[model samples]
Target: MSTYPHFGTDAIHAGQDPDQWSSKAVVPPIVMSATYKQRIPGQPDLYEYSRSDNPTRGVFERCIAALEGAKHGIAAGSGLGATTLLCQLLKSGDHVIAMDDCYGGTYRFFTAIMSKYGVEFDFIDLTDISLMEKTIKPNTKMIWAESLTNPTLKYTDIEAVVKLSKQNKDCIVVVDNTFMTPYFLRPLELGATIVYHSVTKYLNGHSDVVMGAICTNDDELGSKLKYFANACGIVPSPFDCFLANRGMKTLHVRMREHQKNATAVAQFLETSPFVEKVIYPGLPSHPQHELMKKQAKGFSGMVTFYIKGNLQKFFDAVKVFTLAESLGGFESLVEHPWSMTHASIPKEKREAIGVLDTLIRVSVGLEETEDLVADLEQALKASQ
Candidate 1:
């Protein structure tokens, strides 16, 4: 059997051995050189070029790989960079089935850029096993999904999707395990072909860095992904990797507090007369609450709801929470999906996916529970 330290120990110590550094530094030092000197003309050092690999980035990659319970981890320039690399695995005639209510950026990439290459995509609800069964074709090379979808917080049973993928052996299952994080859910453990993340979000736990990662146990797939990153020059800078490494060390602690604060906020919203509907996997009212409990450890800090009153007034009235774009930060954020995050999605499709104008997507931070509730309480009143 394989042996490894606990999650916290690995997060702090993986790929961080001081012996690897000439200076014997406790923390992994950033190697900013564009190219490493080689002993001979043809022979190269372990990391010949920064595009292929960097010291700091390696540390973060190893740390994330350990956390995700995977054999390989590849870091990219941004969340979309990781996504773009994954799509590179496809060809002109390949078909892909993706979650209908996925992030706006992901939807835009599939419909606009990937489709232009003659790769066909079908956006459908992955939660319904029969829908996935009916929509899947023999040419479907990839089944992309998110456990808790963006803006709406709908749940997809990732394991069930993986089971279905088994029927089509050539197809790969990719889960965007961003909202759940490794702390809450490791999709690879559930038999997913690959688990990916927009490292700018929960993996970093701070909004400072924009990076992306993909972890997999498949050796051949790992090699292909790494080649894509190097050939396309879609690698993250050493400094950004350094910042993300620092941010990730505190992930376990931050996630706990995030869950605490978010659970309280969701409960409050469910009781509010101003809120029309609340979507949080942790709550019993959520459609997939029991399944979520079966598939993962805990729900992180995301809550989505529909307002019964003035949306603009509520967004403007928030005192503690900031009106912002990105999530998984130390500070609370409230975003309107229809006008803000999901604006790139066509209006008709947005409506079809249940992303209404009154829908509110909040990234509940590690703020005190009472204070966050009080802020929302007033916002609801003003929205009326």
Candidate 2:
């Protein structure tokens, strides 16, 4: 139930309807005409090009498919072009499973570019539901899910992987909500069949747009995901869809100031001494913090940890964090996921999924929680 049932008025008036235009302008007019002016000359009406349609990318894909309650919304050109337009809904001998701490470019686009197009993937640990009931076979078809994973935030439960991929009623779960962002989860109201997004982190919370999106309620899989985003042109730039719809009109107050400066810098790095572990599902020393409060309504601003000092001396002593390698932005950024974003996963599959080497990953932004906990408490006392 979207199109404005709340989440800050569906992020400032879902699809900003200023009387549909002609300058009634309340804030939706970036329509950079890449082509659109046909009136019965071989019948073309509701838009006809700009890589297949654009009115400022249909008002940020109908305000991010009405902030994920969704009925359709598709944008791309990044977030691995919405995972290559959802791997064109798979086929070449299809089979997938994903989510072994996903997001290192979606595990190198499912093992190096969709395994050269014959599909086939596996990557386990989807909260180990008995190793996904011993890997559902018979041409699997898709499962993916990511929830709060990436750089070791680990969460995967998307309603128990949509109740075990409906025992393959032609399986399809696909959730990567891109670090919990329908402003804190809405994996298609928890039975997900589609809920992608990188939307350049935190729904464009200002890392200056990189875009990518998807959402669905399944009208023929939203008409084959808008015909694979206009047949793989990978749409997205109408000025980065008007700067990601003006950063989703302050996505619920920038996700409550990025979860209040990441729960005050992960409770000062779990009472530092240059901490050793502190994953953060809004902490209860998170071990799925009660299944992240029984399926998220909060806890984002990802906070991964493990650092008993010196990771390049806390990335050369942070001055209000920013060692960088992408993340939801307003500023604070940090990295070193076993040498930046799971260094193409092979150091024994990034330490068999924990991504060690002093793993850090922060992303928490919208700063000023005591200046990001006095710059991570003087960069963990200059990394001890």
Instruction: Give the number of the best model, judged by TM-score.
Output: 1
Please give, for residues 56-125, the per-residue lDDT of candidate 2 as tens digits: 8888899889888888988888888888888888879888988877877788877878899888988888
lDDT of 1 by residue, 12-106 (tens): 78778899899999978878999988998868868789998889899999989999999999999999999999999999999999999999999
Listed in order, each prediction's TM-score against the native is 0.98, 0.36
Model 2, position 376, has a per-residue lDDT of: 82
Scored against the true structure, residue 187 in model 2 reaches a CA lDDT of 86
Q: Supply the global lDDT for candidate 1.
A: 0.92
Q: Which stretches of candidate 1 lie over 4 Å from their true place?
A: 1-4
Highest lDDT: which candidate? 1
* Candidate 2's TM-score: 0.36
- Report lDDT (Cα) of residue 328, candidate 1: 91
> Which pairs of residues collide in candidate 1?
none
lDDT of each: 0.92, 0.84
